[model samples]
Target chain A: MGPPWWQAKFRGCGYRITIAREVILNTLAKTEDHLSAEDIYNHIHTKHPNIGLTTIYRTLDVLTNLGLVYRFDFGDKRARYELAEGPKGAHHHHHLVCTGCNRVVDYTDFIDAEVRLLQEIEQVLSKKYGFKITNHLIQFYGLCSRCQADG
Target chain B: MGPPWWQAKFRGCGYRITIAREVILNTLAKTEDHLSAEDIYNHIHTKHPNIGLTTIYRTLDVLTNLGLVYRFDFGDKRARYELAEGPKGAHHHHHLVCTGCNRVVDYTDFIDAEVRLLQEIEQVLSKKYGFKITNHLIQFYGLCSRCQADG
Candidate 1:
């Protein structure tokens, strides 16, 4: 509608507004699920048949460095990318990855108790290890209902 | 002196034991840190010069499929391996990955409250999403003290 996160970030950083980068970022914005570079290429291949796989990977690298995208590793060989939350935004989402079916569920329902527990953990680690933890990715691997019934 | 996890699992499942598999499992058991397949191969390559990278990967696949080892993707390209907690054991550890320095800290000091919070989250997710939760991996990403200071 107005300006996507990537556009604002690129403008602030003085980076060029290239077509390839725009297309990749737009594809990510439209995705409901976290996607790998291959997945992105496939999604845009019909419309942007000229875009090569290498271009997609390189653009993702640039977007990640610009802090417009967050890359996650879900025990799969490939890395999945999602839009970075806005400035000062809480990275509060957790992923539930089904081990049996490889389906990922993004969980945003953080109860107060769970949030307090994580804050405490961060405080402890910061004091004990002297590390300032900025973000956390928690993934619970399990079987979905269908897989559970099948197993 | 006693049989390790891989040995028992293989024996129970009637799978053949090979030198490559044994070496990889033993290497993982001896380390307190997670290691990639290349790291494992490099550690044992001098003694077992005949072992090929292909063999190491195939053996890891077999061990992983048997539920004898755990595979982790730390937002790095390669997958890291660790021995699975024994049947009666608890793999209650999490990790802190330093984005600036590429350092990984294994955080194992899980308190009762933290454990309880995770249990509650699992229960809530299972009830709402119908997922059969099994295992979890939690990683906090940030700059280490030195990295933060340097930045």
Candidate 2:
């Protein structure tokens, strides 16, 4: 299909659509699941060898700033990027990441409950500590079926 | 007066009691707050200027491996670390993090409900997709009072 909702969000965020951005966006869109910046760089490098690691980092930064992409740290040294603009927004989904094989699956069904709870937490924190909460991420780590079976 | 549950957990998990680990653990223990590695490193480094950034990273990795510390990625470059063990256990509490100032508050009232729901999710993921989830992290992010006031 076309670019995912997150790609469109980048545009909505007033980001200038450039070759590097498009390449990075397309790479993320096509991935079956989350990919690290290094993964993206290596994939794009084979075809567009001119692409620099700095450019990938910069584009990912822009996408994250625009709330168009989500960055996950599944204990990996490098952050992984995934399109945040699915049918639900970035905050709507949680991740189930396989530590054995490094696979990621998005769980979006609990958006309403999660959002409500988060709002309540925000209220409590603000009232008690006068701190403003913005966004958060939840991730579960475990083994995928194949890995579990292998183990 | 003593280490938080998580710090005790690290000791129980066979983690070495090194100066770096102790400094890091002490920092987290003293706070009812969540802090990024950089925050912990900076705070500790002030007292021990020779500690390297890599040591912070390594100490965090060890703590996480032992399930003594929890890592949070609130759309920030550096991940935040907090003591995970509570009166109940490491998995009993969820975190409320302030997006404005990066302050964290721990909440433990929802354990029963979360445990039930998480069991169901685990079953679904395991049955349908063959994913075995061992642990999960839930954090809610929002604007704290200071951010709200400044805004």
Candidate 3:
């Protein structure tokens, strides 16, 4: 209840917890869908018409750089974002993007086999390339059920 | 060798095999590095000064749409491209990107364990979301050894 964890992070990074940033973060935090800047603007425009699209874009950049948000490009030319740490805690997952309909599914079921594979891959890559591996992104592209049915 | 396989694909898609396209494809095909449109233009500019950057950009869009190239976003804002099919055949691989230097290494050692894990994940995701999975992309981000040493 005390200002939330991310506000402290914002202060720690020399960034003031501005209202625009707060609203943008809250908008992303509420949605399971990966939303474009325009989408975020649309979500809050009615209630907070003072917030401009440019401000949302700039704030999203700040949040992403602060590791408070994750940005993604699903081959759509535009970037989409979601809260990096969701209400479910550190909701780490990858994406399943529908090429047909641009629907995105967050695949959160990181099973044991996945853990082992990533461990092995990181080990091999670190040894081979001398990389200090930190993070990874995986996205699968195909048709969602509704799109397939339409086709 | 006879006009290469991709030319036929272009023709099959009703796209003419233009020289600018050929040069762009050749430039990407020859390199292991993911080249931005500017990088491709830079590589071919001295020899083919007439082929402007606009042509390069336009051709890249066509090639990307035709599925003759794969486009990637390494969080660098610029899109990088590589040939879909290489001289060594379909060179399917993931990337390990150095956040410090923007270095990209193709991780091609797809072991049996990795393959099995992907199959399992695809199957599980397909059942859960009813998605007909097609292709995937994986990218790991971190500091390369040089960057770590420099730090």
Write one digit per residue (lDDT tens) for candidate 3, span A1-151: 6767787788888898888888888888788788999999999999999999999999998988888788888878899988886456545778899999788888887555576688789988999999999887778888999999999
**What is the C-alpha lDDT profile of model 3 across B26-143, one tens digit per residue?**
8887887889999998999999999999998899989888877888888788989988875565456788999998989887876556667787788889889999998777788899
Model 2 lDDT per residue over B1-151, tens place: 5654455655666765778878887788777656887888788887999888899999888877777677766555667777766565344577676666665666665556666666766767666666877887777677766667777
Fold similarity of candidate 3's chain A to the true chain A, as a TM-score: 0.88
- List the candidate 3 regions with Cα displacement exceeding 4 Å: A110-112, A149-151, B110-112, B149-151
* Chain A only, candidate 2, TM-score: 0.75
> DockQ: which is higher, 2 or 3?
3
Sorted by TM-score (best first), the order is 3, 1, 2
Least accurate 10 contiguous residues by lDDT in model 3 chain A: A84-93
Q: lDDT (CA) for every model shown?
A: 0.81, 0.73, 0.85
Q: Encode model 1's per-residue lDDT on B32-91: one tens digit a residue.
A: 778888998899999999999999898888888888788877656678887777655446
Model 1, residue B121: C-alpha shift (Å): 1.7
Q: Per-residue error at B75 for model 1, in Å?
A: 2.9
Task: Pick the winner on TM-score between candidates 2 and 3.
Answer: 3
Superposed on all Cα atoms, model 2 deviates from the true structure by an RMSD in Å of 5.1
DockQ per model, Cα:
0.69, 0.55, 0.72
Backbone clash pairs for candidate 3 read none
